[model samples]
Target: MKEIPEFQTERLFLRGITLEDTSSYQKHFVDYEVVRYLADHVPWPYPENGIEEFLKEYILPNQAMSLWMWGIFLKEKPTEVIGAIELCRKGKPENRGFWLGRKFWGKGLMTEAVAPITDYAFTKLGFEKLIFANAVGNIGSRRVKEKSGAKLIGTEPAKFVDPKFTEHELWELTKEDWSKP
Candidate 1:
């Protein structure tokens, strides 16, 4: 993977996640409201060392190899990790995944954060297109993709940390589509 570039949006900062971010990542992200929307593989009662283990085993090792991850923060509170966005070269039917702190919900933060990443994916990372997915009932996530010009290809059976979510929507955004006004 290319070096994970840091981004500064109008109100947020995006940087590669690191071990130093452990506490803040747990503080903001270890919540049911936030994790429920994620895939079923994530444990509900997230283990004490979950974040650290994840960074050490899954992220740090494969980073810059096949995966890229960025910790999301508000410029006003740059030290706190309020969310994360990830991109993987190999798709499990989708190339991206993300989650934001519940307190930051409905603020258009994710949409703002996604802009630069998507641009980098298409223009800088040589991705012809990006596939995104969200639980069928996740309106906020669904809207994020919709606003980004992703077209809904279809829905498929899936599972999330929250058992109620039984299906997921798959959306696609091509370089051609992203370049449009």
Candidate 2:
């Protein structure tokens, strides 16, 4: 299987998620505000063993199967995970999702972390296109997609952790377009 690649930005480092990251993951992800708009799959109150279970069941197996997932960390303090990002092979109006601690909001960190992964998806992984969607009111996520050069395709009902069904704006970025400039 292809090894998951590590990435770096001016201010952040993107590396494969690991069991050692559980404490930091739990520390930053337990905030309601940090996960409010994430998919329903995220346990609302984030169980005590949520990180452990997730790594053992989902992340490790998927990583072995060559899925792309990353733990987002600050360059100065790489041991602490501030957020997570993943590009899944799942079907439908979206295949990418991410969340950052409330403290990291508006820092443009996500946008920086996204660029290389978007390129890896298209240029390295050979996907024809990438799909992204954000809860209608998630302006921060929407901006990240836009900054990555994704085009707003339309809106669709999406499931979220708090509110089961939310209207999400779907967006798309094609490999062709991404290669243009």
lDDT of each: 0.91, 0.83
lDDT of 1 by residue, 1-181 (tens): 2458999999999999999999999998899999999999999899999999999889988886798999999999899999999999899879999999998999999999998889888888899999999999999999988988899999999999999999999999998877322
User: For model 2, what is the alpha-carbon lDDT of residue 155?
Assistant: 88
Task: Record all residue pairs in model 1 with backbone atoms less than 3 Å apart, i.e. clashing.
Answer: none
C-alpha root-mean-square deviation, each candidate: 1.6, 2.1
Q: After superposition, how far is residue 88 of candidate 2 from its true place, in Å?
A: 0.8
Off by over 4 Å in 2: 64-66, 179-181
Model 2 scores worst on lDDT over the 10 consecutive residues at 172-181
**Which 10-residue window of candidate 1 scores lowest in summed lDDT?**
172-181
Query: Residue-wise lDDT of candidate 2 within 1-181, one digit each (tens)?
Result: 2358899888999998988999998998899887888878788778889888988787878882546779999999999999998888773457887888889999888888888888888877778989888889988998887777789999877788769448889988887666322
Question: What is the number of backbone collisions in each predicted candidate, taken in the order shown?
Answer: 0, 0
Judged by whole-model lDDT over C-alpha atoms, candidate 2 comes out at: 0.83
